[model samples]
Target: MTAPLLGHMMDVPLLVSSLIAHAARHHGNTEIVSRRIEGDLHRYTYRDCETRAKQLAQALIALGVEPGERVGTLAWNGYRHMEAYFGVTGFGAVCHTINPRLFPEQIAWIVNHADDRYVLFDLTFAPLVDALAPQCPNVRGWIALCDESCLPAMKTPVLAYETLLAAQDGDYAWPLLDERSASNLCYTSGTTGNPKGALYTHRSSVLHAYAASLPDSIGLSARDAILPVVPMFHVNAWGIPHAAPLNGTKLVLPGKDLDGKSLYELMESEGVTCSAGVPTVWLGLLTYMRDAGVKFSTLQRTVIGGSACPPAMLRTYEDTYGVQVIHAWGMTEMSPLGTLAKLNWEQSQRPPDARRALLEKQGRVIFGVDMKIVGDDGRELPWDGVAFGDLHVRGPWVIDRYFRQAGGTPLIDGWFPTGDVATIDADGFLHITDRSKDVIKSGGEWISSIELENIAVSHPAIAEAACIACAHPRWTERPLIVAVKKPGAEVTREALLAYFDGKVVKWWQPDDVVFVDELPHTATGKLQKLKLRDQFRDHVLPTAAAASEQCPMEPLDANIDAHAGGGAHPVKSAATPD
Candidate 1:
């Protein structure tokens, strides 16, 4: 016969309370440092963080922040945002992060869309808020993240964020949390379609945080000073804010200014060991270091995500800066941890250059996620790493449907279609070739825009490039290459086309090249291919006539740099939206 059943209560609240609550009982004297432009450089110990989060919870509840109501933020990567992150969610309210870089209308639309009752914004975003206030109807209060004297003179009802924190009494009774309660909500950049929210449950978020700290994952620990150059609005800053406390890592926030020099100062002063950001950010930093003679002898690791990280960029960091590049890939819907290309034994054994080549891949799928590639006929393909197909996945953390199934209600046996066309290697590494819609199909064959982009970037003369599907009459579609040059560098049509020689199928060469100042991007730094397609769709070399109609260009064998467009001197213009 069994004795009475015994068990430890399971809950996120319990975990957070232990982390912040009995500080000496769990993590005593652990440092939580935050820096902003002026005022006091706040230093909250783990115990202090706990006390303050509970206080903020009390303040939020006093302000009528009922469980599950949306609380939005338009702020930078600072303590104010961090407090809001924990305090709002700890009180069982949903934290909706509005991407401030989005067009004001888009920001207002998201705020109104979520029916957010209150907003906490960075002080630098004052004018933007002033312009958007009248548009967000449900928002009852606006809290600018500044000190009492720093409050901007504005027409709207603007209260200082720090003042509220100072006014909040440091005592709160956290509610009986429903682990399944919505904890955080973030929207995609809406490159392919309208932006939709991906609401994350507390359970999923906590699990992601746990998985993120594993040795095989980010492997963060207290000894490490972690800085996430990524914005908080982007999938909870890829869950770094929460994972840091769980892993006991000292966190760094760059605040409003995220330039390379600014980031460098923080990295040096904070003794930061690990950082993560999009490829564009590091590209700029690499240049900054070269010109300024800056060195990161202290930085050991960096995680690159958000877009395809070119191999050259990866090599520059690993070789010159003595930093290891950890390639990561995920989407907002996936709670953002899908794959990691960390160094394994075999991969580590490869020559540095070869290993850099492997790191260029999206890497193997992390645990808790299942991935597959399916042909147009909907048949699952082999993991040969060459046969590309639309990627579909499902997991406890990945979204089963978008915030609302906005991607056309695509329903399969149980998989959520991820739009990315990729191949899985025998080693389980997932290489994203291109978005299915961005791929160029000619004469019933598919050509990877990523393959072409990689080839284009290899050219010393070409600084960046983007490939879009240009209309072709006979073959149906061909790659129209848009490229940029280095400073004062000239690239003639023949010279650029010649670079593709002996690289890929001659027919795969771009039908025409357009010299563009820059390629457009969605709100989140992804190439806006749909817009590119619209801009060059009609300008492709007049397609070879069908056998029934007329002419055909010589087709044969040959070779090619992966190209990028977001490089120095990005020629910016209205890239007429698709």
Candidate 2:
């Protein structure tokens, strides 16, 4: 015991500014490309980015931005936005990224909630800023993220972004911020109630960036060029902005235009080696490529999240385009990086189909995250892969409390309940069955709407699908599927019902199917199942009618004709929904 333990290692604080500083000093030549809203490519190097970021920080200070105050950015991903990210945080002010996709009221509410004094917005959002300025009374001024020539006319007093930057000298000193000081603020999508802020600290952000750049994670490096199609406002673009700079990877930002054609051209021209986006964005790109008969030359991989990645989409990318799709799962509360679907040596050696099946599950947790499943009685379940329960997570980056919320605990013991029902296999793979709020309960048994929707959308004729609970007389509630067919693809309700044959239990099947032109989606591209549930609240299932009258209108199989295309491939079975 006397052999004194080497008194704890150096105590350098993990600050957000250090990431950019490291990039400038070591990887100064790395390029960052942005597609401007004016439909042109703007390019710069890390050194230039650092210089501009310092200028922006100086300008913000000159504008009376105080340390620890929140500076908001209501813009798309671009060079100016990146500069704001480092500038605000580097100068010890919290950078709050407001989602422009939210409704105008929500945007104003978020700004007011964060107490943001100033907002830096893109030219494309000038109209939006004009509309919100009246509602957001606390906002002192607005800075358009464009030069004087490009600045749009606004009703409020606006300052040109370049003019402000040009007024300041690049020489500036960054404050030595505490490691635990708040760095950024992002509000949840607020599907249920008013939006709540998730305040991120410098320590948590830097640590998350390091974990995200790990080989098993997003795997950023100097040799790679990453295009993050996920918006900057969404969980800090899933932490790609920080990870890219920390590892000195080339960054490509797509501004104001996420159309498939625009994205394809940008990726091909930039020589992007990898990209990340939600499944809907990829579906658009895939559809574009299929129609154009074009393939990527430099893109080697993509990370799909935000929603489940359809098995068909994964197969199409790998089998047709020679691109590897890495499945990832996260939430705004978890610093947006939880688990990445990278296979280990043992798993990589498995058969192709087996490996694909494994990838279908949301992979194991990366370092810095701890996960467990708990049953109804609050007992921790074993990782035997057979038991499903409420998913709970705790880690350096997971949120302990939402900002400004009073008088309630959001944690159980030390773990945050994720509100997702999932099972962890012996090998540590996480299979998410459904969100707790969206699961259907029939005859006191749980049915996963997510599972049913995944199966339904896999059919070639079906373009999108959503399942919601409908009232039933006997079962209390039953699943009703709302589906959108591909243009010109005629898929009948009976044929769709027959497609589920043998794939799921007979009673577990949807009681009825309804075809709709489109299903509603949240601002972030997730299916708004709550809206669908509301739309179908008064729907009466045939089962309810049969139970009431002792006779059904018609058998479910009546008029069912074998469709031209086969049904979806069987997914690996999981624990029966409770």
What's every prediction's RMSD, in angstroms?
Answer: 12.3, 12.1
lDDT string, candidate 1, 1-578, tens digits: 88998788753443233333443235557666666756345666666776667777776777888988999998878777887877888778988888765557767877887889889888778899898999987898998877788887898988776667778877676566777778888876544334667788877887777767877677788789898887777677777887888867888888766777878887898889998876556765775787788798689998777655555566668777899888787777778777888767987898967776667787877678789999999999999988988889888766665554544545477887876778888878888765554544443233557777878878887888888765433343467778888788887977888899878667678877778887798899888776776575346363432321321112211000132221110000000000
Per-candidate TM-scores read 0.75, 0.78
lDDT of 2: 0.80
Model 2 regions more than 4 Å off: 1-8, 439-578
Considering every candidate listed, which one attains the maximal TM-score? 2
lDDT of 1: 0.70
